[model samples]
Target: MGLRTDPVIFSVSVALTVLFVGASIVFTAPVDALFGTMSAWIITNLGWFYILGVTTFLIFLVWICFSRYGRLRLGRDQDRPEYSRLTWFAMLFAAGIGTILMFWGVAEPISHFANPPQNNVEPQSVPAAQQAMGYTLYHFGLHTWTIFCLPALCFAYFVYRRGLPMRVSSIFHPFLGDRIHGPLGRAIDILAVLGTVFGVAVSLGLGTLQINSGLTALFGVEFSKPVQVLLIAVTTALATTSVALGLDRGIKRLSDLNIALAVGLLLFVLATGSTLYLVRGSIEMVGVYLNWLVPLAFWNDTFGDTGWQGDWTVFYWAWTITWAPFVGIFIARISRGRTIREFVLGVLGLPTAFTLVWFSVFGLSAFDIELNGPGGLVQTVVVEEDIPGALFAFLDNFPFASVVSAVSVLIVIIFFTTSADSAALVVDMLSSRTQEGTTPVRQRVFWAVTSGVVAATLITATGRSGLDALSEVVTVIGLPFFAMGFLMMVALLRSLNDDTVPEAVHHLPTLRVHLPRRRMPRIPRIPRPADGEPAPGSPRWIIPRPGGPGTERPGPERDHSE
Candidate 1:
């Protein structure tokens, strides 16, 4: 069959993306300056919104997890999980934050330690160390995952439970109803497309820069835009091949590999580094994180006037929001049949736990080198500003530096490829008219190549400044989606309140109550409905009937429940 593409979404998104790339290439300086200015303005004015908005999402997700809705599955009551728990966690973790953790696990902590965001702590002191780990965890912990969780929950609930297409606009169906297929819906999807494109491109650009830095450390390769562009080309090609293999055979396997390799690396560092210190530090880190999470979540640097919150915390939140469309949809696709509780806890807990350990190992090891052993991380990362090379430099102080560094490089490459391939799949799904089967290989290839082109263009047009510009651009692009997040929560809550309990669930065995031998009044039973008709007082949307709102075909059966 031919590709089932949405002409409006696909054509318009492609045209706009092409225009952006061409304009950036032709007017690189002006575009960079404009993005920078806009980003700065956002940080100064809307920083509070990002902080408060994300905190509200976290609170909302927690409430949903423990509330009555927690028992509700993303699919039908008879449906069960598609992948094993291990594979499910692996896929979500890899696609969500693998590359980013690798990039920032070491660099961020050290930077924070050297220059704590708060002025009360002395730089490079013990207080600074505690502050560093606390703030790092704040950035990468519960709040970050909550951003992904909100959108994913909305998407999965609508698509699998309500039988809607797997598009961002589908989440707004309760508000828009059939208008989800109208101009407004198309506009929403297009915005999602643009956000996904640029978000993935920014990540691709970061991966390219880091990969180049790895090459420079290993083989003395010149760290320049030309080389980075070439690296993007090579990895995008690999991603294209993976995209063609489809999710099960390609993304799934890569995700499994990513987790395995990452675990191996984590164990290696734990063994080779100061094990006792790392363990003790990790426990303390968790304590500090829990103690300060509330304050940290609300702290917007209002009185401090340091601008550090905007530069780091707000920036990270915006970056994650930019990623919400792509990551959320990918997560929703793989998250069928899980309960809202399981989905929320798994998405918010597992990867976050791993991230804490990952950062603690790398961060504490670097701290050991700086505080007790030799000191070089401060100079390399904070002073010289070689953020990408910080990981390799930290490894240099360990045994078999080259081997571990090479493994790190390979890991980055695979992370880059997996992200690119998964993004291509999601973008194609969003832009497609049909959501029944595997997307056309040619369409997936088009998006994969398009992402590569965008990354390469950003690198070529402004060099290192391009990465900074992309960060700013992502911050601005993320604002709309951040606002959309609030609407999604409202829509989802409204839909859930009106939802009916599944028939199968009601029929399940229940506990019987023993009573004393006394006369009891008999209660009348409710009347049942005729065949093809909804039960009395029940929502009509529960039953699939002719010429009804529930006439849409049920989603495909991937559930393996008995």
Candidate 2:
């Protein structure tokens, strides 16, 4: 395989990334302060925009799913899904939010339970628990996936159907036309590359911390920067191997393993913990989430001025938006041959349902333990601020604690591997000139190593605070993409409307009336002599003309009676 790199996009993105990483290492305080201030301003001024923008994206995706465009496939009419449904869902889920779910499944809900967003709700009360579950579902549910769905749909439609290059700029083909090949397009792709690198780097950093915490819990390993950096190196090396193996052999297998392990872990928790309580709580949580989704989606803390929405809702929206490019492109790459409806519903529904259950299983179990059984989650998670350790602490209540904890650690590592490899692949696609065949293994390895370096550098430079600062940077970078999301919707809608219906879809059987066959009046046959002679006294033969029955034409006379 050729290198196939876009010189401008690759070089500029690499240089800027190196500069940012180097500056973060040298001027950590000032960079952090600047990002902190910018983050504060965004939350204060534009938090409403993030809320409304994400809500709009969700509405737009739903509308497109049910609209006339729903049947449009991401690829050609003859193309079918590249992977089985099970594997497809596994890859998307593993790449999209597997790491986030594992990291936050227990911590977010318990944090909310300990300190409810609203002042009216009492901490650790039933109301607080209900609100906690509702908010957690809101954060990880439809809105989160919708942010991913828009760009993925756009990229898939344009690249797979319209045959554009596989890059973020391809989404703008509807608006930019061939200008997508110019400097503007390069800039768009470069921005995507940067966002993806930092976004994945931040995730790697978070995963490293969680892994470190898990190690600390199990083997009493010291939770320090050196250990975390070493963890990043090891996981990054594994991710490099996966990406080098290419999509089907490397990423798909790892995603399958990740989901299997995750599901197994989830099942073990559900079977061992308060099964009945979790089931009932999960059902009730669904109800609560549905009832409050609208209000919660539109909630911007306008009147409350409590800043809770900024910290949780707006922050989550911005962070996920930053992830849209990496996750979106990766999703589009694997989502070929699927209908718009299947894409939207599957992307929006299944993972979300799984996330709710995952959260409920872990979250409710934590709640039950905190409320009825020996209570230590609140003290560990909320008071002590040991978010990463919360999962291990919660698992200690159940049997096979060490084994399950080890499984959880393995799950996190696999999740980290899948996410890093997927992001590296996507970053390579964004910066490259073409994605016709297998991507260059060296480029994928380079990105994988780059992501690890950034994560490790940030951790070593400023520790956990560096992760926080990087998150702020992501949110700030995500703002432009959030705005671009609106343009993408317009572009997608325009292209869909202008597109001709596929012949396969157009020829589908439809309701029609089959009337009884009408018998036509048969004209009397006249016999002619074999010698081409017109018999004497034979009238001119009349034949029916093009018009109905009455129209006739004169012909040579023939003898009917022999």
Candidate 3:
């Protein structure tokens, strides 16, 4: 694989491990508490606003991408696709359907179905069954992708148009212009780098935890925490070294594995669980998604009575926005040869379709457990000690628990591995861009190492505490950045509307948005008193003709003075 031979990637990986272990001393509990409090506040209060704004913007963007920029392409319109349809779809699938989805697709709906969170101050009220579907669709639907689309659009324009490096600040290119290499630029890059680190590290950490649980459940391997961590570290090291071999080998293989495992797991669940309900839920949720689409799209409960709106609607938007920088950049890299409309549709809409089916299949499985099974998985996940216990509790009721366990382990391992490889690539992208066309290998090494160190530090510091704090930190940082990001998209969209302007203004490769010209509107003229009546003798309100002094356009002499 030529992986271990890559000195730069290998050295960076080792350095990351050493630095992270040292950094843990400063990762404190109070920091976690602070972030938790902040996260709760934002989710409770400002969540809906974020959701509404992001969703509205995305709907408009989809329209622009299709109606206005249908023929728009990015890298260069060519006959060959950026990637084979299969590879392309798999890449999108890999980027999104990670560890959380694997567990939550089944677990979350069950939790909500059993003891739906108290929608209001009422003592024992539960969300209605119908509201439950809406809630799931809400979290897994447009708003989630809405927040995600901002950075996708940003990265596309910046990478393709501005010729800047692939760092997050490249997003600000339409606004910041030449300053991208300056002090302000450095700050943007630093925050993005840190956020990306926190994101990947948290996922790795979570993946390891899940791996431990799955191994114990499926294979009776009860390693100590330290041993468990070592296994994870070793696994990560191996993956990173493979990444050093470059994108074509390690990352591609891992991502491919991730897709296969996830699909296999879903199919297994479908086979074992209630397939009828799974199919029904998918059809029903899809309909609910389209039917209440707008109300759900913008629903911000000033009153928290509807658990559906507040909990799922806003939180997913913020969460997706939080990941946009890293994920969007990754999407852009794989999207070079795709058209603007195709990229938007593939990245934004198609994923939603996949998610709807995926969640329904898994969710209905959980619901089936609650409705007919003996385990109280739906009733007890929140109180369960860990994610695996909760997920395992549900699986215990399935017909072949051992097979499900095996699939779960596979799902956890490959998903985490896929993410680690992709993250290595993303970090490299952030690090590599230098002054012009050449991407610096040293820069790539620096970021890859930086990511490892951050992950390690997060592990040592309050363990998962650093990750929890960092997720909140990411949300806080992304919010204001989103405002500016939105403005830039707006400007680009505006430029698309004006047919006389150059097509390059909107980042598309052609003049695709122009509409056929239409007749100008008619205007009325003022009557002097009556056509036959004597002229209203120079009425003080007398208006001038187009070429006269009284015209809206002043005389040339007055114009020159002004």
**In each prediction, how many residue pairs overlap at the backbone (N, C-alpha, C within less than 3 A)?**
0, 0, 1
In model 2, what lDDT does residue 201 have? 92
Residues 1-562, candidate 2: write the lDDT tens digits: 4677988999999999999999999999999999999999998899999999999999999999998899889899889998998999999999999999989988999999999998899999999999898899999999999999999999899999889998989989888889999999999999999889999999999999899999999999999999998999999999999999999999999999989999999999999988898888889888988987999888888788999888888899888888999999899999999999999999999999998889888999999999999999999999999998888998999999999999999999999999999999999988887765356789989999999999999998889899999999999999999999999999998889777666677668987999999999998676665564665557656555678795765789999999
Distance from true location, Cα of 195 in model 3, Å: 1.2
Local accuracy of candidate 3 as per-residue lDDT tens digits, 451-488: 55565556655556666666675566556655655675
lDDT of 1: 0.91
RMSD of each: 17.6, 9.8, 12.5
Give the runs in model 3 whose Cα sits over 4 Å from its true position. Answer: 1-24, 117-129, 305-315, 434-449, 494-562
TM-score per candidate, chains pooled: 0.88, 0.89, 0.78
Window of ten residues with lowest summed lDDT in model 1: 498-507
Ranking by lDDT: 2, 1, 3
RMSD of 2: 9.8
Score candidate 3 by TM-score against the native: 0.78
Worst lDDT window (10 residues) for model 3? Answer: 1-10
Instruction: Estimate every model's Cα lDDT from 0 to 1.
Output: 0.91, 0.91, 0.63
